[model samples]
Target: MTTSVIAATALDPRTMAAKGAIELRQVRKTYGDVVAVDGLDLSIKPGEFVTLLGPSGSGKTTTMMMVAGFEDHTSGSVLIDGRPVDSLPPRERNLGVVFQNYALFPHMSARENVEFALRMRKVPKAESRERAEAALDRVGLAGLGGRRPRQLSGGQQQRVALARALVFNPAALLLDEPMAALDKRLREHMQEEIKTLQKSLGISVLFVTHDQDEAMAMSDRIVVMKDGRIMQSGPPEEVYNYPLTDWVASFLGDTNLIPATVLERDGNLAVVDLGSLGVGRVRDRGAQGEKYAVSIRPEHLKFRTAPVAENGGTGELTSSTNLGATIRHRLSVGGHDLQLRELSSDAEAPGRRAAGPVHVGWDADKAQLLVLEG
Candidate 1:
């Protein structure tokens, strides 16, 4: 299928507002005795696509609600373009919100629904109609504006909801799992579309999702939250490659966490003792401690015929699973189970199996040394 390019002129000038720069300072939300958000501090630049990523009950949604003016924050301030809007209502905040359910009016046609926000703002009928059609066209739903929510497919309905959000030209867009209802393929397609559209229109977006892959794919910067506080925040690649905590390392992607004791440190490199396995060097960023955990991505582990170097460790290949593009192997090393992933093309033939003794190794530079935390 051919993908259509979104034009710069897709957004109507009258409706389009300047991109928003959002800042949340010491934001905290408490529900009686329980705190949902704790001293959260975040800043999103104008036209930047930032994602709040975490597991359920991590306060991602609550932070978005406070920014959208849907839920009142207990303290701190939410500033859009450097103006505090803590007491402002949702409508007056000029922030577009798209929920997981799409939240479309069942009885209203697509065009009408897209124009509803304009109507509430007292826009003239003729102008509202023109802007609504333009918004629908921008989202590739031009000719289907007359269809109601039930008449459109799930993806189409989602497009209509997005059109409605864009019709008013919000200063910023807040999306809370908008593609959660779609299938995997459709969700991926929508993710690309949203990213393209946001870049073309130069609108700030605060996207909230629990899907790590989706967040990594769409975000310019990712803020990882846990227990109502930020565990780490940085560019997608930086956060994934250098996680500050074990939780962030484990949550962002699959990893092998090996317990080790730091023997010595030399600049950015640290020599660590992996009990019963062997000694290895890893990238350590000034961590002064005896106990540490080494994080290594499964893909980095290479299966060797025998111990190759200082980084090599002997293990028993317990099992292997064929996953089409990749082969996943389970190995037992030093009484701990570790996973090793290799490209299918690089793996042995499907009929051939290597059991018993095996060697696993990774580059010292690729391994991350993290301080063990409670």
Candidate 2:
């Protein structure tokens, strides 16, 4: 059996300073009149790790390709190191790139693969071999340099690809879902490795991924894109904890979105009636008469001994499932079915056949209220 452990970390200010290396100024791309990226204005800092996170067809990959000089923009400029690179060719961009499908040369060994870029740059044979070996060593594949892509495991091959990209010490690195082929565990391990490598080398990285967890785990800042434009961009904690829009709230993390009308606002707090959850106080209240969205995370809800319905917090235990150290309970509340997660030490996992009117409650301060525009 394997036990997973996660350590808590404080917010790092250094992470914020590393945010704007590559700046996109009104960048847009169109494929035969079909717009892919519509005037995206994004800035990635030097030595910072930023991720372009969005679902499929969200213009994330297209943006990355434009930065890499692989795709042309219909309008606007791509600035690298504060200089426009719109007319520059891919070969002159000085950027490292890693794709999802490995993109390895099956006929070449890992060493040869890593050396390919250096060789193309006209580096001597001996120097290319030395640099390739050193790069492999950085990725923990020094001894496996002779192995071809077919000989290495998925994770190992990925490391080789990473090594190859980093070998050039380019101005910026572009990774388009590089770990998509690896299993969950290996993918996680590689994610950490990539983060550590980027930090130690002080290399700026613009990562493109659809996986929310991956973006949250590795990014210093996250740029959430949708329908060819940036929906939101901020530090992971800021984006996750304080989403400005309803779509941003739902996209970054697990949020129980409930509709509510803004009753009143005093400074940062807004008093809202959750319809069935009684009066709740949430942060970031907008103008009066505006319908707001109440965002509640599962961990914020607690189980109470009293009847939830009687207490005005509507809910009844519909089901419970044991998920290792945590127990998740399904509750039916005011025509809405929601999930509540309680730690094993805090709450016991109820039997499958157990019957009860479970009480669930959450502090008003824990909920986030967003002013709905539409």
Candidate 3:
């Protein structure tokens, strides 16, 4: 892996041009014949929390490395605040970065670790110490800066890493799986902390994570990548509810995809035949393909006593699984299995209401007809 410095410029935070916008124009990266990132174009507006989400080998981390100047792109440009920084060194890019591992120096105190960047830049000892302490305090580590990485709790060590990254007052922050090493509880807690801190400071953030829930919870927008290219980019709700392709629908969350034969189309709405589930109108986002599928999230499937004017029909409940706070019910309509998830608290839920023969249905607005990509 290439070594890239976590960074900042010497300019005063208040006086520097505050736009932390990041834009990647037709950027591509390749190692021999294998393309790591393929003609990627992305933009992060200042103060926006944008997340690059995908599974392993999807090139999310590679994109971040390119943006941070850790890996030079094979083609195209990277701009920070509308200015091209393609030739700048990692340090000169002035972007704070945190990684999966906290990477704190075990031999140094938390304060010393946070002070390392400033010290390397030849800042006066008194100012560096003062700034490091304040940065630690900002991340809720007031007096704990005296503790070394090994002496701190996992959450504390994470805070120290955050403090160190923010101590430089960089224009933007890039986090590559920053919470991967922490436990679930700590990860959630830190996610909130990081979001709150980002909003308070109004700093642009480029986050990389494979966790779908985390991306949904934190991002203003999510860029879903697959095979080194973007599959979809939109608000979490939009992407999750209305994925344009089969791969995207399967990636974001649990969804019931019913095969559909497109009978006709009028504008963005298509009237399709779903066989036994009956003919229904669904959202058609101009996807060019010979095959199509209607995507309805498990949570959106409701147990209607009678079929409504939507994609619904009488179905046999094959089995019901109690998933603690939520219940998952498997229903068979015309040999097509559909998964329905309902909250235990809902009185009309399948678990609460007796199973066996039940009418399964979902509103037309809740169903999205997307392309069935090969």
Candidate 4:
């Protein structure tokens, strides 16, 4: 983990209170007749890590641009703390922005690159050097200050960019897919480092990414976007396990969606018939629609010798794949292809993969009935 000295210099309550809050009220953006972002209302609390996640052209990037003052909104207002910042330029927004490409000047050394921000702000040369070197040290690049962007590793270069953004002590950090170029292992490493730094500094972060796992791993809250609109926003587990729409269920992660019919309702719980999967009770959000489906994540599915008392059925195992920590099994149940994942350490996992009848089951609470918007 990357440690920082910012804890000693943590911003005061008044400064955090003023710079920590980022809010967009009915913010909309358009290009002639085409809408890029439609009525996005979001809030990033002080010290909170909020991610805007979606596919390409989902307006997640556009929304971040607007917040950073790079793009102008056609309607609604953008506020920092409680004051409007719609008229502020990107530089004037007091936000530390790290772009997808770690935009560093190749001509300058890491120390020089980090000092450029303080230089632009007219800090004295001595003060700029002191603060720049300190910032580099804070990001675990203390001795590499003399290296140019080309001389540093991808991770080191990212540190320089972060140091530059932090040297000025901006209130909030705006990260736009900052880890997109790194390899999978490196990207995951940087995710941990960035989250650690954010918590250490106690700064608000408005992060944008299309990678669902990335959002789940780093964000305090996930704001899912779809076609310029927000589909769902909540804690990672809540949004992933209890998505309101089938689109969200599939987008967040792999899920086995089973067609279901609401047989009865009791308050927030509903007893539903799963046809071949058997009868089960699931959460009822009182969604109004005739199209209903139960979403069960592959990891939550279980295998047993007999059908579960509630939601279980006998199925033919088609194939099984050893996926490192877990084994993935595909089965054909009632003409529908369903998959279940079991930890590799499970005693019964290997037996289920053997050539025999496969009995599949899911707990009642694990099945989530959702409205199919499509």
Q: Each model's TM-score, in the order given?
A: 0.96, 0.90, 0.92, 0.94
Per-structure clash totals for the candidates: 0, 5, 0, 0
Q: What is the C-alpha lDDT of each candidate?
A: 0.87, 0.79, 0.85, 0.85
| Tens-digit lDDT string for candidate 2 (82-110) | 88889999867878899998789999999
Relative to the unseen true structure, what is the C-alpha lDDT of residue 132 in candidate 1, on a scale of 0 to 100? 89
| lDDT by residue for model 1 (1-374), tens | 22564443657433343657899999999999999999999999988899999999999999999999989999999998899998899999988899989999999999999999899889999999999888888787879989999999888888888888887878889999999999998888888998988887888899999999999999999999998999999999999999876778999999999998888888889898888768899998775554679999899888877776577688788888989899899889778899999998999876444646788898988899986768
Clashing pairs for predicted structure model 4, backbone only: none
Q: What are the runs in model 3 whose C-alpha is more than 4 Å off?
A: 1-17, 307-310, 347-355
Candidate order by lDDT, decreasing, is 1, 4, 3, 2
- Per-residue error for 223 in candidate 1, Å, reads 0.2
| Model 3 weakest lDDT span, ten residues long | 1-10
Q: Per-residue lDDT for 116-170 in model 3, tens only?
A: 9788768899999999988776677778889898888888888788887778778
Residue pairs clashing in model 3 are none
Per-residue lDDT tens digits for candidate 4, residues 1-374, read 24333231422334543467899999999999999999989988888999999999999999999999989999999998888999999888889889989889989999999989988889999999988888787778878899998898887788888889878888899999999988898888888888877877778999999999999999999999999999999999899988999999999999988889989999888888888767888878888797899888998888877756677777688878889898888888766798898887873635535676777787777878899886
Q: Pick the candidate with the highest lDDT.
A: 1
Residue 158, candidate 4: Cα error in Å is 0.8
